[model samples]
Target: MTHKRKIFAGMSAIAAASLVLTGCGGGGGGDVDADGNVVIELAQWWEPELPDGALRGLMDQFEEQNPGIKVELLSGPYASTREQLVTGAASGTMPDVVGLDGAWVNDFAKQGAIADLSALMTEHDYDDSQLASQVEVDGSTYMVPAVNFVYPLYTNDALLADAGVDAPPSNRTEFADAARAITEAGDAAGTAMPLSLETPSGVQNQVMSWLWASGGSMLKDGKPDLTNDGVTETIEYFDDLYQDGVFAPGAFTMKEQDMVEEFTNGRVGMMVDSLAHLTMIRESNPDLKFSISALPAEDGYDGKRGIPYASWGLGVSESSDHKEEAWKLFEFLMSEDANAELASMAKAFPGNVASVPDFVEDDELMSQAFDIYQAGYPANEFTGLPVAE
Candidate 1:
């Protein structure tokens, strides 16, 4: 902090200063601006619906708080964010500050692209439990969460009533009963799970939640252990679900988006989905009675019930010359106000826990996520599993 501040000297006391703005118009750039401010290019896949200038507002506030630093946003759709990040690192054109998907954290670290944030975590007092587990590998940390995703179970109350399930299922045995009962009542499939290796990641998400809730894990000997008892039981149980028509036969080929479509169309009685759809649920089914809950666990499993977590994190590039400034921007972005603003629009878990209580739209999901932010394992059991595999 001491040495980095000397890198920029201002024009006296600044007579009504003007902030410089370079949007995501073209490529990335991390240079000294004409105004003597350090330009830090920030690349993220912030949704377009976030008040149009939510990120811009953050940048403006950061500039106002700390003079002589300008953050340029290189925003794009989520579909291309990962590709853009990978290509940028490969071509030596990466932004000074970039947002990455939770899954990319380990890969980026292996490629030597992102700086380790261990020291920063210590300096900033960031608890590992409060942060997403995906950003940390071995004994080092690579990224700090930008926004974390909160996944919750969505249950159709009408279907449950029709099936005579007065309360939500808390364990796998009851879960099966509920699924079968709902399906047998002629409403639709009992539950919708994305099981298709067509999108391998989606398969991991679908399976891992069930496994974790059953107190199983992916890494038995530092690799995916498909032979784990819980994993095997989950596979068998899901097979039963498919065979009994509790889950659609196409569950083996359905993607996450497909689940979303079917659930929204009132074809599924229960499903696990992101908090992002809080608004979409009301829009899709105005009369549907639904409730949210944590995923079910095994009847006799004594271990903790874990859920899937997806994170978007902020990290400085490994080769960047502005590590200190980059860390500053990272801190600013993760501040409570900034975190809440982004989370309010993103409809996901906020990076800062202080912002959790303010959320009310999907309060159960947000509150649950906040309480257990330091909890849960990955949705993917294995690493580097290609889609075709």
Candidate 2:
């Protein structure tokens, strides 16, 4: 059978297991009590392995605030979390609230598994602009953006200075020159871009950023435009960068963490990564002097500097019977203070635009990151492409 079919089969098994567990009164599907206390299961992928506890803590706080509601956090590995959610939706056993990546919103929305949060926002007087465009589709909100991270060039300032470079590159040409200088210094690998073919996430991330920087998008009016000059140019740039020995020997096999670790260990002078790396850098090396700046632009392209904003949002499952309570939980999470607190706890940037100013005031790297985010463009969404299954 096809890979998708196999995934579906595995998901079906998981759903069946969940049903059996629920029937035995060993899971989160128990009925509500007379005290108005409702047990709501929240399916999420932020397990201990992920290291982000803000979401969990937020849920705990919600439970405390609303004594009548109890939220059960269901954590799972990232590999099967999405599949489980899809299966839950299909089987009408989805959790009350779910933490999902913005990219997955389109797919779930298309499947009619997510509720229309626009009405809730309107009723609550919530400002939609606080959320990113990706979470808002066709004038109806489907999710509450929790945290956002912008992709930027991470530079080791001390290493650059040791190599006689005063600052990070501002444009593509300057970056190329600096990479050569660092490589010639003979201290370590000069510059590394994630050129790993094995890790499609890295490849896609880099390509999408370059594509945006080159004044091109993945889809123009909802159709793939592979023949677009911008797309071709970006791909060719990666091929050339690979052939030039700028990347590590097995960069094609390098994952995101691997690349970040290399830069953190001083094995690389510069690396491109998400802004969320700020806290990791601080924790990994307290003395490390690194700076985050916008990715360099193509030589002559005058378009906005592009930084991919990676984020997750909270959404109520349409299969849920407690959407009102779920919305209350969602509203609490999206509140300014709540978002700020979670962002600080998670060591991540906030999704609420208003919270950006607060984040900037406290974290310098986040300040620069906010600048990049404001100057960046949104991720491209195509209409005709089949959503990932």
Candidate 3:
């Protein structure tokens, strides 16, 4: 069966199961309490299991601050979360609050699954500038940025030194020279440039980063620009990298986990991956001297120092019966203290600007990550091709 067909089949099963449960519970009773407390359910895909009472603790604090409010957390797999959410919205069983990746927020807002928060922003004194740029779509915000994930270039400092390199390369020419030197010395298999053809999406994302760094954009004034010289140069650069034997053999078949292991195990000199790899790399190799840097740019391009930023955020459903209560919870979660707490619990980056102060003295990885965040550009998730309507 096709991918879309399988997704539809899985959603049908979920809807059937939800209906069975609803029938057993006597079907669609009131969602509020006797004391007029507005109960709101929050659907998220952060983990397969509910967030071990950490979110509940936050909810308890929210309830204490607002006496007539309650929040429930429901968790599921990320792959199925969006489908289930859309299904629920169609069936009028949508949760009051929902957690979504930023890319999905635009489509959801356009479809009216999420309520517009422009008015709420004014009433709550919320500023769009406080959140990351990626979460904002065409001037109106659909969701509040909750956590951010950044992709950085991971380099083994010791390997570079052994290969007679004193420091990491800040641009493409020096990077290629270093990679070739490492490969010749037999200390490493050069650089494992991420170009997995098996997963075209991954290849496309990497290409866009290079294109942007080369001072090119997928769109110019809302029109496609695939025929530009910068785009061609970006593609040719990767093709040359492959032809020069810099990339690992059979890289087209290499999955993300394989790439991570290759670099961590000292087989590869450098790899580009998420910030989450820092903890694992440090634990697995205490003696491993590595540094994280923003992805390199073309030699003379003005936009050369850019990295792709990915993240998730929180939103309220349009069909929600308890929007006011839901917004209260949302506001509480975005507060500096709560954001810091959530960042600690999730081992993820904070989404609020004020939380930066709290995180400055927390840990080295977070400190490095925050630096990258300040220097990086918004990630390009829509840099290639047009989606068929």
TM-score to true structure, per model: 0.83, 0.81, 0.85
Please report, in order, the local distance difference test score of every candidate based on alpha carbons: 0.69, 0.69, 0.68
User: Model 1 residue 38 lDDT?
Assistant: 85
Candidate 3 per-residue lDDT over residues 19-75, each given as its tens digit:
424421221111676777666777777644325777778778878988877766666
Clashing pairs in 1: 129-374
Candidate 1 residues lying further than 4 Å off, grouped into runs, are: 1-29, 47-49, 122-134, 301-303, 361-389
The predicted structure with the larger TM-score, 1 or 2, is 1
Candidate 3: residue 98 Cα off by (Å): 0.8
lDDT of 1 by residue, 233-270 (tens): 88888778777778854766788888877777778888
Extract clashing residue pairs from model 3: none
Q: How close is candidate 3 to the true structure, as a TM-score?
A: 0.85
Query: Considering summed lDDT, which 10 consecutive residues are worst modelled in model 1?
Result: 12-21
